[model samples]
Target chain A: MVTPLEIIRKKRAEAVNRIVSKGYLSTIRVYVGMATCEIAAGSKEVMEVFRQAIANGLTDVYLSQKGCAGRCNLEPTVEVIEEGKIPVKYGRVTPEKAREIVERHLKKGEVITEWAI
Target chain B: MEDVQYKMMLCDGVSCIHNQSKELQSAIESELDKSGIRDAVSIHLSGCLGMCNKGPILIVNPGYTIYGGVGSEDVPEIVQSHLVEGKPVARLVIEEDHLYNRFFRIFGDVDFFGKQMRITLRNCGVIDPENIDDYLSVRGYEALAKVLCDMTPEQVVAEVKKSGLRGRGGAGFPTGLKWGFTAAQKADEKYVICNADEGDPGAFMDRSAIEGDPHTVIEGIIIGGYAVGATKGIVYIRAEYPLAIKRLEKAIEDAREHGFLGKDILGTDFSFDVEIRLGAGAFVCGEETALIHSIEGARGMPRPRPPYPSVSGLFGKPTLINNVETWANIPVIILDGGEWLSSIGTETSKGTKVFALAGKVHNTGLVEVPMGTTLREIVYDIGGGIPNGKKFKAVQTGGPSGGCLPEEYLDTQIDYESLAKAGSIMGSGGMIVIDEESCMVSLARFFIEFTQDESCGKCTPCREGTKRMLEILTRIVEGKGKAGDIEKLERLGSMIKKSSLCGLGQSAPNPVLSTIKNFREEYEEHIEQKKCRAGQCVALLSYVVNDECVGCGACKRICPTGAIEGTRKEKHLILDEKCIRCGQCYDVCKFEAINKV
Candidate 1:
């Protein structure tokens, strides 16, 4: 006999739990722009390169795809997020640059200042 | 176990998806896993964030720091510096100051979103739209619960009336008054209809609202049902908006499961249910009478309306129809009180109005601002002015039915009365900024064509008058203007406005009349001088070789009709008789050789 109040409370608690488990508060997230403009700008190849690199070695990261980043001219946009840090956005990335980022930045923990948007 | 410390929101709206936001998401996840910080962060894929031009946008919580134009390769650096180390990557950060100052010459001292007061769009891009729990967490459905438990039907109506909310579906009918009318009607069977048939071109406020927070609309509709003593609500959304429909369907299902909708809503005696009916993409179906007719399994046509929808609607019973944006505003008005809302906007028009700022502007997207916010602020400040430094010419507000306003009227405050005073109605929030490049005559012709095509043809004035007006406007744009064409158009336009049965017919001639009134010079240039200053009227333009031509022979080689005849490194001659006006040579010319005169 769950009341409506209890159901709402339960839903709220579940939302909090979902948020935590999905890495809203604790996980580093990488968002790749996969909109038509970005696809036209060779984002598909860049995304493929990132996926292959992740499968080869990357860990503790949550990688996902998203829609366009408004700057059409600067397509193939990506944003990275981690707890207690400022999110970094990079634009106009190629497949080779994506691999180099995975090796130097993700693995060795160095910010690639030149590639950052 | 360590507690989560940060939240990251990635915009996954229509435009953002086009920019490869999906790849960016996976790359971030991979980086976080590598850094072993997966347990300390949360990521949300959200809807449009208004600044769609700067997608795929990422917002980090705690500071609301936004990063735009990000790519997969940059994900590693973000993980390294920001995820592992405590410092934010400076270069990638989208500075608030920069967004405000980028077009300082145009906007002067005002910020992009300085005048914007987001009420209906408060939860957009802030929550995951698909997740019901996320919506519930943000005090969603609390208004419905409050309405059901604490207030009576008359009381709810009074509060709404006090809020001074008007219909957002083009005509600014008082929402509270409309509800009161339906409530006063003694009908056993009553219905609440949400007019989600957004048929206006380039307007997407309602679609974005539904996609961003579906639960809000659901809550608002349910509350309206309660207020009007109605047992059933129907969302009349167009089939064209597949994403909004999907999200709304999910939201409705979730609400029913959670006891917010269906029988005995939120532990109260008030029982109401909502269902969706898809419109077959007819622009005329947006009108109340036509919509009611369509809902009744008849042809989508407008009938005479003295016994309005409130008296005799939806199967000969009283029906209350409100726009999607109007319904979306209900929950907030109920929760925050009408006095709070009424205080925000102008004296006449209260609360925020959502405008789809589009066409030839820098920041082309959705913006929700208070009623009194000037067009100057909307175009220059929020929209970042005309793109590529083009001179501002005119702005068309209120869709095809609305009028075009010239540059001098930019300072006019936006409200129902103010817009009406400027010869344009505060339509369903489609504001298209026209630059110097767009010919006013061609623009008027384009809108008249749309209205003419969309007219339901049931009434003689709308169907026949619009057709006649379209013919005259078309001929003018095609360089076949007559002496009395403008006067004939004005006569036909006023006749349509007076004699038309429905709103579609009455407002059909607005684009033509308004453009002629505002940009008469452009129209005269086309008619008298036999030229289009904007070069948009193809019939009025002639291709010629200019003095700037370096005689590269590129135009001669590229001309499909072989109109250009010249020796190598010599001035080209265009045989006007043989020219097809394809403009292929114009595009291929390297030395600015080709000109359209």
Candidate 2:
């Protein structure tokens, strides 16, 4: 019979496995602000553009949607989390700009200095 | 093998979800899949990280780096460089200095969380609330296990007493004393209840707590039950909080399955179970007696407080009822010890208090601070001061039943006694920072109207008295106030305070009374001069075309009434006879030509 301590250990291990299996240990992550304010600021369209770019065979990218980033005035904000490097936050991104970000920043390892928040 | 080396937590709280966090989450998952490193990374949809205005917020583990204002297009680059190349992204990091300076100015450059002492909110933004394993890993049920295995019911109550926890539901009643009162009663069947019917406008502290960490509240409730010698626990949550309800129900089921709740919990003889009761969103039900009635399937109304829910409550038996935040503090008190918890806050009030900072503040969000923290620190340091550089006016605390304190009271310490002495109650921790632009008369009218509507009419003083007060306040704001209106309001206010049946009636006059006490000059100006200095009362305002008028016909063209007249390229004039005082001309004019005085 499994003791309570054993159950707790099992649960912890399972949780860790679940997180590890889902690629949380991956080196980089991209977060898109999709809060209501961001959506009103056309983050949905920007997200679609990114999806289309990835569908067009963009490789090695981990894209996820996040909630409001606090600054309502700077909606449609994008955050890039790359391992061993400082994360970059880009603001006021449009769909066309989204495509440009994928090609110039994601593909070429270049930071878009102008759009950073 | 440590298969995962990094963790990404995305804020999925109400505000974040409103900002399209779901779309952001899906985008991240697809990017991870595309990167072919899905097995190495984990994405957690967590609760509010408090920096609401800076969403959608993303926190990366290993270094605890937070990135704000993220977008979908930035996903691929983040994965390729950070995950594959083992290099952290420099530009995406939420600037440590900026975040620290923005929210923690009171504590000075400590980061957004530096000023906050998060006791009840310990697990909220840090963990995925829906997952039971996540809760267990955080030592969630350890308190319940300890209470059942080691501490006697009296001993548990004594520890809580030593902690000096007061109800976060607004009354500031000593929680330990309430538990003792209920435990001392001899009864066959007793119940411990969690009051989650958070009905205060602009107050989301309880909702956020439940959403961020449902298991913590459940754990607290189980401990309360053990202390009070109750076998059954009930959480009386409002139906409007569907997300919190969903998570809490899931947590209860998981706890039962894990032997933390139900029949012989943790293999001990002490057994306890919990159930959920939905309140139909009545503000009055937040009161303990009304909540008890609602749980019993009655008309959610409050009777006199002789029995006080401790002696006779919910099916007419001994019961213990605490607010959502009060329950959330339980596990922490057990883990940290009563003395440790007591040492943090003021002498009278112990532990931290969670406040939902709203209104015209720069950094409007949820903040938890120690009890002795002054209102000045909260407004300026943590809330980032009033927005648009407006002069800080009065701040409203304790919902409609609480009073509004003027600028002079800004340094007042935020505890029950201190706030009461300052003419405002600490309430349920809804701190609305009023700006110079807000009219005190109108503000008083708003609270009176709210209390009048929510009054159950059980008592004559609250039901009819509030309506009469609202009429006088309405007349005063409408530029038709008489000399004796203020006196009449004061008289009625004091009468209601003395004669009211429940807490709702007793505190109904607080807003009107406090506003008059603090900003009496504004009231006098509204009555005697027929002018609202803030220009909020439209009835007392007049529109005029100023010297700066460039008359591009913008104001003339948009004016619903043809009050603005003048040819193109010339200064416009407002015809006083025809002007409706709608302020449309003021809004439409590109130049600073139109003025409302």
Which DockQ values do the candidates obtain, in the order shown?
A: 0.13, 0.11
Sorted into a CAPRI-style docking class, model 1 comes out as: incorrect
Tens-digit lDDT string for candidate 2 (B1-597): 123555577776556778788888898889889988888886766434555567887766645666777788777777787777766677777753221112211111122344566678766544557777657656667677667656889999999999999999899999999999999999999999999998888888887778767898999999999899999999999898776788789889988888888987777777899999999998899889988988888898999988778999989999999999999888877766787677656789988898888888876767888787789877887777887879999889998889998888999988999999999999998889899999989998998999999999888999999999999999999999999999999999999999998898899899999999999999999999999999999889988888887769988888888887899888888888888888888787788877888
The deviation in Å at residue B162 for candidate 1 is 1.6
Q: What DockQ does model 1 achieve? A: 0.13
- The TM-scores that each candidate's chain B achieves against the reference are 0.82, 0.82
lDDT of 1 at A111: 59
lDDT by residue (tens digit), candidate 1, B1-597: 123456667766556789898999999998899889998876766444445567788866545667888889888887787757756778889854321112111111113333455678766644557777667767777677667657889999999999999999979999999999999999899999999999889787787778767788888888888888889999999998776788789889988998888888767667889999999999999999899888988999988888989998999999999998999889888877787677667789988899988898987766877787789988887787888989999889999999999988999999999999998989999999999899988888888899899998888998999999989988998899988888898999999999999999999999999988988888888889898999888888889998888788888888888888988777889999888888888898877868899
Query: What TM-score against the true chain A does chain A of each candidate get?
Result: 0.77, 0.82
